[model samples]
Target chain A: MMESDINWNSIYEILTGPALWFTFIFFVGGLLIRLAFLFRLSRKKDRVIYNHFSLAWGLRSIFQWMIPWASASMRQQPVFSIVAFIFHLSLLAVPLFLSAHIVLWEEAFGVRLWSMPDGLSDGLTLIFIAAALFLIARRRIRPEVRILTSAWDYALLGITMLPFITGFLAYHQWGPYEVLLILHILFSQILLILIPTTKLGHMVLFFLTRAFIGFEMGGRRGARSW
Target chain B: MTSPTKKKFEFENNTDAPVDVDRVRAILNANDGARIRTWLSICSRCGLCAESCFVYVANDRDPRLSPAYKFSHTLGEMYRRKGKVDRAFLEKCYQIAWLQCTMCKRCSMYCPFGIDVATMIAVARSVCHSQGITPKQLAFFSDHCDKTGNHMGIPVEELVDTCEWMVEEVEDDYEGVTIPIDQPDAKYMYTVNPREPVYYPQDISYAAIIFAAAKESWTMPTFGWDCTNLPMFAGNRTLAGKQVKNVYDKAQELKAQHILITECGHAYRSMAFEGPYMAGYPDGKPPVKIKHYVQLLHEYLRDGRIQIDSDKKIKEPITYQDPCNVSRNGGLWEQARKIIPYIAEDFRDMAPNREHNHCCGGGGGIMPMGPDYKPYRMASGKLKADQIKATGAKFVITPCHNCFDQINDLSEEYDLGVKALSFKEIIVEAMIVPDHLKLECEK
Candidate 1:
């Protein structure tokens, strides 16, 4: 279909209406089900004596791991840690601080937070793209990482990077603005939908994994997980 | 590189035949739980866990031995197939789970997602146990523990006789020192690994001497004296539970306030942590408090209950090997570190001591897997051997029996030239027995 002939309003409605709500429902409902399933599994009833500083130690470990220099993994893989830190930081910052995203929040919830400048947003988007590419390259170049790299692992990376790439293109108006904008929204929706079921679930589940490990190892076992 | 001893445990000769595929599926299904499901789901296959594994590192970073690969090939495959895997595949899972990995849980520390790889391997082991595919030696020991209340099958008469012999042996060192047997309502019910009586009876003497010096009210029970639970290693949870129950019942019968475990890692972990759960006790709490010997020694040192002669320290440089169960899994690392300085003239720390220390490769029942797996176990301990060698210490003091045995093997195999001694041995050596307390030999 010709770009001009495309019904932009209808497309925006579909993307923001059914697609957005469907992905949100699936993402939330699927995560809840998975969590409930996990809880239903047989748990051995054991009263473990936790250390007095377990909570503090667990929180310390979580924060320590979030910093590249503070983690043991950083000593072994400094390059990966640096790139991953940037990628994770930008992953949260770029999307949350985008002017368009803030506007959407203002429209939907009547609350608006600070938004990043266009130039800063553009710079972060580029860094995010570069970080994703570096991760994919590392997986390919490193023999150890390469062997564990399944097709789905690559697919998850591609899916994660799509929204940023499309947003960049749409923001720069490199291609037809209407088409790129729709593509960005579509990719974002797809990502939201797939997250709960795929490795992307790590975004949400990482907290539980870290907290559980911290409590079990640091608190109960008196050992540091980090 | 199979040793001649390992040939005796030939898979073809095993009497407990492999179960059908359906049975394997059922076992896997039974083990399904939140922990397994979450771990299986969240691991991003980032390969960060690879560096933390000794086997993977010792094997020249072989992808096949990586913790991720081990999980994928065994538990991951089981999850994928929903337990409908064929016999050949099940057998492969048995080797990967039992022989390849030691279930040390070190990798979990490095994992950003904190996947409990060791527990998943335990689940895989449980599956193998259901199929009767465990190592023959492990099964034999578990059966021995079931029948004779010890891993080595030493009868009650021999156990009592051995305690009496140890008491007489220690009498030469200190006067008025006695090894009480079956003393009820004591403050501590002291238990030990069967290996003490079978192989190293002197270790028992050392513990007795330390207890006597501390003037602690401890007694050894004749019934459930074997604190080491082999079934916990063999993946027989039911039998593991029974063993824990036996010990609990014995302690309750003796009316001891505390169950004092010797310098054994797995025994302490299984009893103090896994025991209550295995015994089906409410909230998985044991009937009484459980304390490792290291904790007791630490308390004694802190409270001036036992006096260590700081001037009589060993001149040779000594290092400490953190036992996986006691240090990492049990959280008893600092206690041993605190006690080492008082006993040794010069103490060295391993590069990655404490929770991050590498496994001795003899854990998860690998030590009891016998001669057939000895070469494999020794080879996998290359990292541990290198860690010890780097310390350049004359002696390595480990508070756990398994680490001591494994470090001893690593020292011999790698020619590290380090003697592996228990914490009690070092403590006894540095302890000052007053002239008034020392017994003069009768001419």
Candidate 2:
């Protein structure tokens, strides 16, 4: 590893520097906007569903499920779900456990973490890109799904594949890798901003919904608190 | 796409025709008014409801039976073509209407958006009502409720006579129990589901015994004492309203304290929630405070009026199946929960209990919807059966009559070996009638 031996041409770096600004501006600003709206909901349904038996245990279970430590929902449909599950698992693992991403976290956020080998990271990243594209194609190709799908669904799926596609290309310094890399970071940042806003809100909202059902149904029925 | 064969199920009344379309739509519009517009607009079609529906679970993941598909035939078409769809499309809607569902709201519990598929199907039924393609069974029952003041065609004489009979039975257990029907100044004119009078007369007996044991001030009206509504279940709102007004007028005539709907899902729903809406009364938060049987009984149990025998408890493990109309439709869970454990000793739970519990596979008039979906009914029952099997419970304590019917049919056909009993049956089995108990409230 020879430091400062290789360099991007001045103009290319200049082009990418503007992209960095785009990433940072949207990433920070969009996150704030997401949080502001989410917190602003006037109705306090949280109290209704908040299990009082053990608040800490409930929160721990919720956090574990959201992080999805050993979740079994995907087991409901094993064959179809495994590939997607593996892809999701690896996508999460690679983002949290990649040497490059890990190093970046330490640089920017002052966090330290272990990372996987280069081959493992590369393989997982490839799986994520391939699996995402497969899902999109399957969605378009399936008639029943196509009938129910909306414009936002297609756009969302396409946006999801962007970070993976650009990230894969950005690796190995292939065609347009540097440019694609900036786009990858851009899309990833956009996804972070979207997590609580879009249907991706399913991540935060499902537990709330489940807990609501459990609590209301239980209380109304005079069962012990959930 | 095609009309269902009427030969599958024998319908009792055929003279009356289905309502005309404009009138049907007008009735639905009057009831829902415009809420249908927003609810239909927000469907994201996540398909979690498919997992929840009995038909879908029973049919091995067939996309056609999914509630989303069923709705697409009617509400879906209305939305997609901006209501400009052809008669062929409307005809397809009718087939999905009569064949696919019984209007049970089990799917709504799983819906992330809380879209009431049962209500939408009722809209389709109202559309069918307009087309004059109403099912013979529903039209008959609705008409029966209209003309006879009860869906079973129980005449005023027979209704009073049944109550008189109940009064006599209660005299055996309690000292001065008097079960009066149509008496002029009674505080309550209790209305029972037609099921109790027609197929399960003993259910009425249990209610009477319990009512007497509590020494409560309640009476049954000779008219409006039958609470079952075919039109509500069949999805005809005009007929549903007419069906409801029969009870409302009779209850009003008696100037009763509260009309306690019998242990039937649709009856309680129609009376407690939809009845007020259609009869020019308030919505679910009604002024009249029409109580469910569970509410009445639970209150009686709570106040030390009606008590069950803890020693008389069924030795077998018993679990409850919550009917959506009772638990979710009206949000009356406390009453049932408080009362259920008192009736049985070995209380167990079926997985996904309460509002999340699966449908009885016979609500929304699926029992009368026809025999065309009987296989689907049994198949869907497997999910519930599996849930019960997990609990290792021998009996399922379902409060609603149709739940008893559907679960009984499935248990018999599928060898579930699980007895389906009404809360009354279990309660009566364990009831300890006080020797000095009197019918008249001391108040």
- Model 2 has a DockQ score of 0.08
TM-score of model 1 relative to the true fold? 0.94
Q: Put down candidate 2 lDDT per residue, A64-88, tens digits, no spaces.
A: 3343223333333344355656766
Model 1 alpha-carbon drift over 4 Å, by segment:
A1-8, A36-58, B1-18, B440-443
lDDT of 1 by residue, A1-226 (tens): 5766879989989988877878778989987876666554534311232212256766776787898867686667888888999999999998888998999878866898899998999999999999999999988987778888899999989989999999999988999888889999999888888888887878767876777788778876778788
What value does the TM-score of chain B take for model 1? 0.95
The C-alpha interface RMSD of every prediction is 2.9, 7.7
How does chain B score by TM in each prediction?
A: 0.95, 0.87
Model 2 chain A scores worst on lDDT over the 10 consecutive residues at A42-51
Q: Which stretches of candidate 2 lie over 4 Å from their true place?
A: A1-131, A134-156, A159-226, B1-45, B85-88, B169-174, B183-187, B280-284, B332-337, B370-373, B388-394, B437-443
lDDT of 2 at A118: 80
**Which residue pairs in candidate 2 collide?**
A220-B333, A220-B334, A221-B333, B20-B130, B21-B130, B214-B305
lDDT of 2 by residue, B1-443 (tens): 12224443333322344334455445444444222443454454545456667767666666666777788668656555544544455556665775567676666554544455776787776665555556666777767766776777877676667667766765655566667666655556677887666666667777777666676678877766777778776555666777778777776777777878877887877776667555655322334557777777787778777677789878888888888678766567667778877777778877676655667667667676556656656766677777777777788877788888888887887778888877766666677767666334531
